[model samples]
Target: MEFHSNSTVFHCDVVGSDAHTTVLLQEAVDALAVKPGGTYVDGTFGRGGHSRLILERLEKTGRLIALDRDPAALAVAQAIDDRRFSVSHNSFSKIQEVLGQFHVDRVDGILLDLGVSSPQLEDASRGFSFRLDGLLDMRMDMSQGQTAAEWLASASEAHLEEVLRNYGEERFAKQIARAIVAARARQPMVTTHQLATLVATIVHARGRENKQNPATRTFQAIRIYLNQELENLSLALPQCVQMLNPGGRLVVISFHSLEDRIVKRFMRQLASSDGMPRKLPLRANEVRLLSRQTLRLVGKAIRPGANEVESNPRARSAVMRVAERINRT
Candidate 1:
């Protein structure tokens, strides 16, 4: 999946009829408030689902800059032939630098569909799905960093436990971590099923909270830690806020509680402004607002409609939050 030539236009297609549905597609794009002839950024680009819609809403002069850490996605992005479109092969965390390269100081809108793309999970070769017996590789950017298997093989018990508890929110993190360490000492922990089985064996469920697979949390923890999903997200959020033009929108679709919490807190703090105390204050109309309010939260987090979720179960976990940049007086 190599992308070459800036002039080529890509018409992305589903390789199989079974390609995963892009969760919360319309809602995320609508939140962008996309306008013709305005520059926008689709930070995750995945299969160009959101990107194509953004381009359609733009006028001839309007530009859309799409970024994806996955080379596979970049390849699809490169295949698109519109002169108004350009693709960057970089993580959204490097948003500032990548946008700077194009002399794009500010954008009309930015959209981040955070977390793993569907292809990364559906493709057995990518090794992201626990349902398949593939390699334990889960890096969004395969060109760099350690695979999940390598990390698990050498990670300390304490560090593994911390990741499981913090990222996966699994109560049996300590036991799961111990199991992995002990198992690896006997033989290198490789392959998805192998690790999954190890986790299931150690995490016993005796009570009512026993329906879900025991390996689910442990796998999620490893993937999140190895990919640094939360850290990357934290880095990207402020960059998105800083890069938007006045009245520009930032629409984020976060799949898990941690990501949603970060988005919620960032927006709440921005909206509240933590204004000065009403010390010796004048009338309410005469009061001056705080100096640094940059963002205004759009609305409450949006979840998928029941019909959409029934069609694509992956859509069930998605939550979209939107915020708009304010004009600095």
Candidate 2:
């Protein structure tokens, strides 16, 4: 997939229907408090489900800048012929830079739907799923970076264990890592089924039974580590906060616990008053003047409704958190 300066076109063949039932569709956009004449950003343009909704709420003068690391996603984003919308082939972490390129200092709202998209997961060649047998490449951006197969082949057992434990929260990480190291010595682990089978074999022996596939956590760990998903989120959060104008909304929909934890903590830290000694001999007004609050939490985290989850199982794990930029005097 090649990215041009003005527009990015994806060369890879896209499999399956490009249609994605975006989780919390109306809820997420509503949280944005979008202003028809103001500029906004969609950090993850997965199939443009949310982008289209945002555009509908915007006027002719309103602008929407969409960003995505996946070439396939960029292809879908390019289909939007609206003059008010522009797509960028970059990660959400580069939100600030992308805004600068558009001469946008701050935006009225920013929406980020993090993690892998349906199209990427459904396409076997993209290697995002273990259920479908394909290459062991789980990269969000296949244009660059080492594939999951290459990482597994070269990573030490300790490193593998660390990733599985920290990123995937897998309990049998040590055993799985040991097994991977031993198996790779006999032959290279280069396919999704190969890796999945290896993990299932080890996990099953431990007598663990659940609805989810045994290889789920391992696949997630490898994908997260290889794609630097968590790191990108950490970097993008501060940038999103800084790029929002006063009263601007920041809506984030995270899929897993790890992602949700980071979002929750970041928002809490910013929403809390600056840590100051309570014993200080200062009046209430003086304390209010001294306290620094960057954000006002909108409400509690939101989860998909039972009907939505039944229709789209992927939405089951999603959690949306909303906040607004606090205007400082």
TM-score of each: 0.90, 0.92
lDDT of 2 at 240: 94
Report the C-alpha lDDT of model 1 over 46-87, residue by residue, as the tens digit: 888888889889999899998888888877776777778877
Stretches of candidate 1 off by over 4 Å are: 1-18, 205-211, 274-289
Candidate 2 structure, TM-score to reference: 0.92
- Please provide, for model 2 over 1-329, each residue's C-alpha lDDT reduced to its tens digit, 9 standing for 90 to 100: 22223333433332332888899999999999989899999999889899999999999999999898887887777677677887778889989988887778999999999888888888898888998999999999888999999999999999999999999999999999999999999999999999999999999999999999999999999999998999999999999999999999999999999999999999988888655557779878767755667888998999999999999999999999999998744
* Best candidate (score: lDDT): 2
TM-score for predicted model 1 compared with the true structure:
0.90
> Top TM-score: which candidate number?
2
Q: Candidate 2: where are CA atoms >4 Å away?
A: 1-17, 274-290
Which pairs of residues collide in candidate 2? none
For all candidates in order, the CA lDDT equals 0.82, 0.89
**Overall local distance difference test of candidate 1:** 0.82
Single out the weakest 10-residue window by summed lDDT for candidate 1. 1-10
